[model samples]
Target: MDRVRLLVLLTVFVDILGLGVVIPVLPFYVERFSNSPQAVTTLIAVYAAASFLSAPLIGVLSDKYGRRPALIGSILSTSLGWFIFASGKSLLVLYVGRIIDGLAAGNLPVAQAAITDTVKDEKERGQVLGYVGAIFGIGFIIGPAIGGALGHLSVTLPFWFVGALAAVNAVLAYFFLPETRKQQEAHTHPISLNPFSPMKRAIQQKDMCSNYLAWGMFGLAVASTQSVYALFLNVAFGWEEFMVGLLFMATGIVLAVNQVFAMRNFWLKKFTEPKLELWMTAAFAFGYVLIGVASFPLFIVGAILTTFGQSVLRVVMNSQMIAKSNPTRRGEVMGISASIVSLTAAIAPLFAGWLFDLRPSLPFFAAAVFLGIGFFILYSAQKTLPTTLDPRQPVVSEI
Candidate 1:
């Protein structure tokens, strides 16, 4: 791999590591202040809501300014948020911390833009994105194990450790990662604070709108289930933090193996990206149904299926989106994609949390329903996609 891609991958790794460390421990940590499962999911929703409002602006800035600064700023903000969450005594303080972090949670999108900025070929871009997903899986594999160990000692320790890692990541990014955006042709359009503007612009394009809708529903399925994963395990199977972490690690292993091996060797080689997208959706829907069943072995099978589906779907969708975007607006388009996911992240958790309180299986059932719908949308929209999956001419949109 080239220096830029390697550095971008490193940045993504650190970000995901911190996130992985927190996920298994968050519900237990929050229970100290509030016993409600809703509190835990709400905290996640707060962060996503803030990210939804700010990520687009951050992407615009990266397009105008450079990827390096946006990346560094986002990492630094994440560190601060972790620190605040670690020190907080009340749930409100935790919300404030997540809000701060979410407002600058543009690291993944900006990092992706940086990687794509270096590659011109659509096929090569898809391969590179698989590497990103692989790194994400690697982070998950290691982070949760460490987090479980740390949480066993003290719930706050994981946060502090992740915070410190984020801080160090910001420093590495600043000193080593070079700017990837071409300064000469940077967008000169006036910066817009309205986060929805990019979404609106994206939706105006017919093909892009179709993909975004599918992506949004996919986001809803993943986000809602993710928010309650640990809690569901605890409630249904009586798994503690350590057991939950191990489960997460197992799923991460599936994710990493698929991204690293299955993606290049099996899935991509066997199916076209469009076909993979549709098949993965079916895999997700069935997986969620199995997960909603009240059996431990069935749940494990479902988790594996969903994780595999998620890993492949994410890469193919991103590659397809990149092929459809104008070179000048790659950053903007990535930001819009992240924003759509974040919007779903913000909305899904609340509804899922409510459903979970009523019955642990309800959220998974809801997620399955969303995936079923997403599959139909993507299948219907296939006719509108480019016949060759090659990069198209820039679709001009209103600034």
Candidate 2:
């Protein structure tokens, strides 16, 4: 791997590592102030809401200014957010911390843009993106276990550790991570502060609307289940924090193995990105159904299946999006994608929390419905969606 890709991947790994550390323990941490599931989900929604508002602007900024600065700024913001969240004594403080982090949550998009800037080949780009997903899995594999151990000692310790890690990450990035955006391409477009403007423009583009909508629905499905996962495990199976963390670690293992091995060796070799995308949505739908069953073994199976499916599908879909979008506007398109996911995340948690209060399994069922709808959208629009496999064909160029 090249230096740019390595640095970008390292940055992404650390960012996700912090998130993985928090995922299993966040509910327990929030319970110190408020024990309600709604409170926990509400905190998640607040962050996603903030992210939805800022993602596009961050994208545009990276496009105009440079990815390195945007990446460094985002890392610093995340470190600050974690510090505040770790030190918070009240629920309001927690919300404020999350909002700060969310507002500058442009790390992944910028990192992706950096990779795209460096690597020009579409097929190789897909493989590199799989590596990104693999890193996420690897981070989760280690981070959750560490978080669980630290949380067992003190709930706040894990957060503090992640905050420190982010600080160090930022320093490393500042010294080592090189700017990847081309100078000629930089400063070509005027910056737009309105987050919704980019999103509206994305939807207005031909062959992108259905893709964006499908991605949004997929995000909603994942977010709904994820926001309530720890609570669901606790409620459904009387599992504690350690076990919940371990379960996530197991899922991460599944994700890592699938992305690294199954993707390069089996899936991509056998099927095209579009075909895998449609099929994976169906797999996700089925997995959610199995997860909704109030059985531990069934839930484990479902989790593994869904994790594998999602890890592959995410990479494939993103590869398709990058291929279809204009090369100069990759950052903007990636930001729009992030914003759509953020929007769904903002909405899904509230609905999931409500459904969880009604019935533990309802949220998973709702997730299945969302994936089913996404599957339908993709299936119906499959013919219209352009593929990058044919180098002779023109991709979507209109901004």
Candidate 3:
């Protein structure tokens, strides 16, 4: 494993450590300030909007400047965002904090670019990626429990605590994180903020568009679930903040277990490439449908199943995206994928929030429908994928 990859993975996990801790608490905290359910939802929406709008630009920056500095800047910005969020005495400040987080949302993608940049062999890519997933699961497990305990102090404490942790993470990265971008030797254009350029480059290539479709569908499903789960738990079971922590912690444990012990080889063997995506589509569709109809017991059941399904989908989708992309254009392809997914994530909360208001079941039901659509797209498009689990240089095109 590249030492740089390990650093970036640690950086990602550390950053997520703060996020998982705060996420379970965010909606409830918002509700306390403004009873407007829509307003609370919009709080999420604003962050997503910032992420969606900026991801492409950020990716290009990584392309031009390099992944390490871009990631470093994003981490520093994230630390600042948490500080603003923790100090906020009003909803406006909350909005400001989220905006800051959203603007720096390219951290994860840039991290991915670093991984891609450092690792040339596909098999090692999967292994390194699996390690990253395991680290993320580690964050998920500890973050919420810590947040729940600190939350007893005050709702705002976790945000500040996370801010402190993120600052620690930034320092760690500055000292240790390595640069992976190799553009210094290549023929490449300087990154620009010109709005139409990235999109034009991304779509101009045929294979790039195909892979991006798979990438987009995965994001839509994943985002819908992440956005609405808090409201669903609050409304359906009247879960307290601590209880929400337990559920997230539970998911994190499961995810961690699979990524470490079971998922990598299991998915690699059982659901290879495009074929695996179909299974993922079905699994995701089934899980969300169950969530829509579940009572208290069933909600738990649905959560467990959906987590399993999503883990598989995420691994397969990401692996294929890397494999399918041509080496010359990998960063561009990855950037397009991230931007589309971020856009989906940004819009999803607004839709899920409104749906949550209409009916507690509305978000879940919509999740199923949207995933069903994504699944169908994957199912139909399966032929485009390489047949085996082995990685190859990707070639995507409109068919």
Candidate 4:
């Protein structure tokens, strides 16, 4: 592996591993503050909302300044946020910590931008990003198990662990990850502070709006499913913690597999961005229906396919987000685009939780219906948007 890639990937791993440590314990921590399960969901919503608000700002800042400082600051912000979360005794402190973390949420997007800075070819971007994502996914797999095991000792332990890890990430990023943005080249453009400027372009241009809305709707389609899917599994099978962990690890497995091989071997080469998108539309429609009605074995199968299908689709969507944007405006464009998706993510879980309470199957079925509609929106956009491919390699047949 490339040394710089290793640095960036290791930094990401350390950062996410801390988050993993909290996965099994976060709900329990929130419960200590309130009797309502909605409280846990609300906490997550608060974080997502904060991220949605901060991403554009971070994007704008990165565009003016450079990636290194932005990344270093981002890590410090997360470190402090987690510290507050670990130390806090009340809901107010938790919310404050989440807001800080939201600001730092720019890390992933900005890092991707950084990767784009270093990665010259398009084909390599997918596989490289997949490796980046795989590291984070492995963190998710390893984090919870470690966190859950640690939580047996103290809920606060994992938070401190995450906070410390984030601090370590800051140091690693400082020493290791290079500033790849052509800063001297970037300095030629007039800097922007008006956060709405990026959105204004989308407003003025119909194609930009089309791409933005397609991504937004796709985000919304999956939102309710995440919040309710665990509940669905629980109601359907009375799954215990280990079983749920097993299910989560299953998603991670597919994610890892796709990152390592499928993305490069089949997905990226076979499907153009538009074609892969269309397949995603079809696969999700079928997958959700399967999730809604299938028995345990079938449910597992659907969930895996959903992961594979979405992973395939998202690889393209993210690359397109970068490729389509004016390079100067990339940070702002991606941040805001992510915000649209994050907005849905913020709302999806709450709705899913509520729907799950009413009927376990209801959320999956509802999401399936919405996904079908979302697919139509994507298809409409696909027809008009020319196939945008990576710059690195020859295009392959549609799988």
| Regions of model 4 farther than 4 Å from truth | 184-195, 390-399
lDDT tens digits, residue span 297-392, model 1:
998889888999899999999888888877777888788889989999999999999999899999999999999999999888887655446654
Candidate 3 residue runs with Cα over 4 Å from true position: 183-187, 388-392, 396-399
Point to the candidate with the largest lDDT: 1
Model 3 agreement with the true structure over 97-127: per-residue lDDT tens digits: 9899878777777777677676656556666
lDDT of model 4, residue 144? 66
- Model 4 scores a C-alpha lDDT of 0.72
**TM-score, prediction 1:** 0.97
Candidate 1, superposed: residue stretches over 4 Å from native: 392-399
Cα error of candidate 1 at position 77, Å: 0.7
Tell how far residue 336 is off in model 3, in angstroms.
2.5
Higher-TM-score candidate among 2 and 4?
A: 2
Compute the lDDT of residue 121 as modeled in candidate 4: 66
Q: Residue 12 error for model 2, in Å?
A: 0.6
Alpha-carbon lDDT of model 2: 0.87
